[model samples]
Target chain A: GQQVMQIPQYQHVQEGEDFTTYCNSSTTLSNIQWYKQRPGGHPVFLIQLVKSGEVKKQKRLTFQFGEAKKNSSLHITATQTTDVGTYFCAISFGNEKLTFGTGTRLTIIP
Target chain B: DAGITQSPRHKVTETGTPVTLRCHQTENHRYMYWYRQDPGHGLRLIHYSYGVKDTDKGEVSDGYSVSRSKTEDFLLTLESATSSQTSVYFCAIRVTGTETQYFGPGTRLLVL
Candidate 1:
């Protein structure tokens, strides 16, 4: 069995501010993926980090995979109202099965 | 939005009843999963199918079972539902050998 934990269970940020959430695993992962679920919406695929110590960016959002492949982070710069949602980090231990973290719910203030 | 659809967008059933939720995908993906979302729990996987007639349990599989008779359809059945089983259920699909999973609009179920 695999377990994934996320930090800052909930984050509230004012518009134009920055936010970051961390994900950690008790076991090593083969790959990790990120997803965003909007308010009252389904979870949507964001990105996946496969290689250790990998860093990828999507516009103002930056994702990082730890060197040990046991942790990851998602950082959003200058957040906007559209950024309000729950961000989840999912990891696969050795195959297709994925275990999702508790997720970090974000709320943006006007 | 990835050609994935969930039926009975909302359901209100009584306890001790058997409820089945259907997930249909036009993409014909090899991997299909059922998950339930609750407060502070995020999304907990119920079951997943790798192919036709192939399914396995997930972290929160109790009281839930799934069947995949075709590559495009996955069904999640709750036998003898309870109040604790009331939550928003989502169906997701991913291509073989890929890590990305696309989810369908959730089906909100309430057991009275």
Candidate 2:
């Protein structure tokens, strides 16, 4: 069985501050996907990383995958109120299903 | 928005009762999945179906079962509900072997 673990179970940051979350897996993954879920909302697909040591950006959010394909990170610059949510990392290992990490819950102060 | 819809937005059932949650999709996607989200446990997959009548268990499939008799519908069943099963459930669909998955609004279930 594959297991994905995420660091910083909870984080609180002031508005305009930066934040980052890390994810590590027990096994190599073919691809990794990131998701965001607002409080009391369903998980929404954010982005996916496939290549080793790949980096992608979405506006103020930057995502990076480790060279071994077993770790990933999501960093947000100048966080806003809208950025308050739980971020999850899901890994796929040549299967139809995905194993999701515990997730990092972020809160932005006013 | 991938035309994914889940029925019974909220449900409250007593323990030992049988409950079935329905997931309907208009996108005609071949891959459908059921996941449960709790406070500490982010989102854990219960089961997934790749095609009609073809299904596989996920990490947390002990107390749950799934059926996919048609391409548009996937059903998750709890034979005898327990208090531990209280959580928010999500239904997601995607193109076969694709990374993009569209999730439903989600169903909150409480078992007493």
TM-scores for the candidates? 0.97, 0.96
Candidate 1 lDDT (Cα, 0 to 1): 0.92
Q: How far is candidate 1 from the true structure (C-alpha RMSD, Å)?
A: 1.0
Compute the lDDT of residue A71 as modeled in candidate 1: 95
* Tens digit of per-residue lDDT, candidate 1, span B1-112: 7799999899999999999999999987899999999999988899999899999988899999889998899999998999999999999998656778899998999999
lDDT, candidate 2, A28-106, per-residue tens: 8898999999988888999999999999999999999999998999999999999999999988777677788899999
**The candidate that achieves the highest DockQ relative to the unseen native structure:** 1
Model 1 Cα lDDT, one tens digit per residue, A1-110: 68888999999999999999999987778889999999999999899998999999999999999999999999999999999999999988666677889999999999
**lDDT of model 2 at position A49:** 97
Q: Give the TM-score of candidate 2.
A: 0.96
Candidate 2 lDDT, B1-112, residue by residue in tens: 6888898999999999999999999978999999999988888899999899999998899999999999999999999999999999999997655867889999999999
Screening candidate 2 with a backbone cut-off below 3 angstroms (N, C-alpha, C), the clashing residue pairs are: none
Model 2: per-residue Cα lDDT at residue A21:
99
Candidate 2 reference-contact recovery? 0.85
